[model samples]
Target: MKRIILASAFLSCASLSITSTAAPMDFDFSGTFTNDNDVVLLDFSVASDSTVTIFSSSWLSPDEGNGFDPILAIWDSSGNLIEEQDDGEVVGSTESNGVTYNHGTWDSYFTQFLVAGSYQASITQYDNFAVSTSLADGFERNGNPNFTFDENFGGATQALFNGVWDDSDPRTGAWEFHILNVDTASGPGPAPAPVPAPATLALFGLGLAGLGWRNRSKKA
Candidate 1:
């Protein structure tokens, strides 16, 4: 009986350890665009229902014609549009001779809490000359051009930019982004007690009973 109790205690400890050591659900990605009509696509999957927040940024500078405007869009697995953003906010700047050069116009930013499931995100350029309402529509209105520019860097799946260009071609650029999932219940309120397995509960009860019986024996 003593050996059986010891083994049960060991098993319970192992189970607790496994339950406590869960991997974090976060990811980071970066990519560069080579062609005027280049688009970067990222695919991600969520195991269970969760609130996922996504953020995106573009490389910007004060150098003439060095800044690239970026646009971000997300879609469900079925190709339905979820959300899109043209400019998030100014992320960087440079100061020279008491002058502050704001580069916010070129940088892009976006965030959204998504439900658990498979989803895809697309990053493309925000054409200064585009006339269409949305980037995706602009590409369709114009002739679908082949995205063939090679930016010398690779990570995301590339596709033709699906939007109208004010001019005849799309702009090229680079982007950095990340995703984070939040556990709202664990953030503020008291953490709920973990439910013990039936077998573990039974073993724990037996151990208590054993101690009670031993105490009675000593008293007698």
Candidate 2:
């Protein structure tokens, strides 16, 4: 009886240690647009209920001649547009989420809670001088003439195309971007698999040994 109780206690400790060591999901990437309508695509997967945050600080103000004004768009695997953001600092902008980015001349940040799934994201230049989706129009520049995709933009695989716009114009600089996933506890989805610590593994082994001893004692 005491051996059985000891086994249960060790199991409890192992479980606690494993859960406490799990890490959040995050990714950071940097790329550049060589022309006015350059676009870059990134793919990521979420294993549980998570808040996906995408942001960039590589934009330049209008005063900077070669500065880039970035636009970000996210889509599901089926090509449906989920969300898009142009300016993170715009007051009362729903896409901004009231978060300010101070990395460069301009700020761009976006956040959304998503269920477990695969998603695609696009980052492109937002040229005020170009004919593109207006802020009031929700930045719907996916099919617009100013912005075009490569032949494999939304194909079966993830791709990054250089200067793929139909027009000759392209954004003339490089850009840096980041995507992060923050797991939440309120959803009915499965949690991410925990990474067991060495101590947790030791406790787990102790539990198995205790159970083996208990079984032998009962047999005797």
Candidate 3:
């Protein structure tokens, strides 16, 4: 009788652990921005310590100039910028009318290790670089073609975009993004496991002792 109870207790503990585990998460997103000045922010959470990858390389090969150049940025739950990426592995090019347009593809990517917590991912177009370390600091480029640049690098739109100094091309603001290795709960950390009560813990010990005695008896 005692042996059966111990075996049942062991099975119960194992079952509890298995049932409490969270489902894995991987996501792909596609959307368009309202206009050149638009930005897309995604909010997600990981249940435990894990790695996250953001990618936007779709606008490279077949259709180069169809979409805007993508810039990806990750922000911690505390609204601090972790890192940002302007372009990916491949450069972009397209030919329209008669002129051959040469520029980076609509690609941006990054893989980062993050603690269990909530985070934000922001996507902007070319010349719209994230300006500060804080998420609230905003991007460098607004809709205006002629404007003062960032204070750190201030001038008449002080950026040499697509081989043109202090200039940028008109973009449709189309975009896509992917996120991998996240918890299904979309939380900052792993699903919280329920703590066993004192009585349950005592049972665990008793059950282990009983199981061990039965094993010894069988061996003998």
TM-score of each: 0.45, 0.46, 0.55
Give the per-residue lDDT of model 2 (tens digit) for 1-220: 0000011111112232333135443444444444334445544456666787777655532222323556666655454556666666533212122233234423357677877665555555553121232211222243442332333222313222213223332333455555665221111111112221222222222110000001111000
Sort the predicted structures by TM-score, highest score first. Answer: 3, 2, 1
lDDT-better candidate, 1 vs 2: 2
lDDT of each: 0.37, 0.39, 0.45
**Tens-digit lDDT track for model 1 on 59-158?**
3432323324555565555655666656555465433223333445435444566665555555445431222333233232123234222321122133
List the candidate numbers ranked by lDDT, top first. Answer: 3, 2, 1
Model 2 worst lDDT run, 10 consecutive residues: 209-218
Best-fitting candidate, measured by TM-score?
Answer: 3
Q: How far is candidate 1 from the true structure (C-alpha RMSD, Å)?
A: 24.3
Candidate 3: stretches off by over 4 Å: 1-21, 61-65, 90-106, 143-171, 184-220
Return the TM-score for candidate 1, rounded to 2 decimals: 0.45
Off by over 4 Å in 2: 1-22, 60-67, 90-101, 127-172, 182-220
Clash number by candidate, in order: 10, 6, 11
The C-alpha stretches of model 1 lying farther than 4 A from their native spots are 1-24, 61-67, 90-105, 128-172, 182-220
Model 3 poorest 10 in a row by lDDT: 208-217
| Residue-wise C-alpha lDDT for candidate 3, range 75-183, written one tens digit per residue | 7767677777766544643332232333343366557898877666666655566667765566666544322223222122323222112344333434555566654
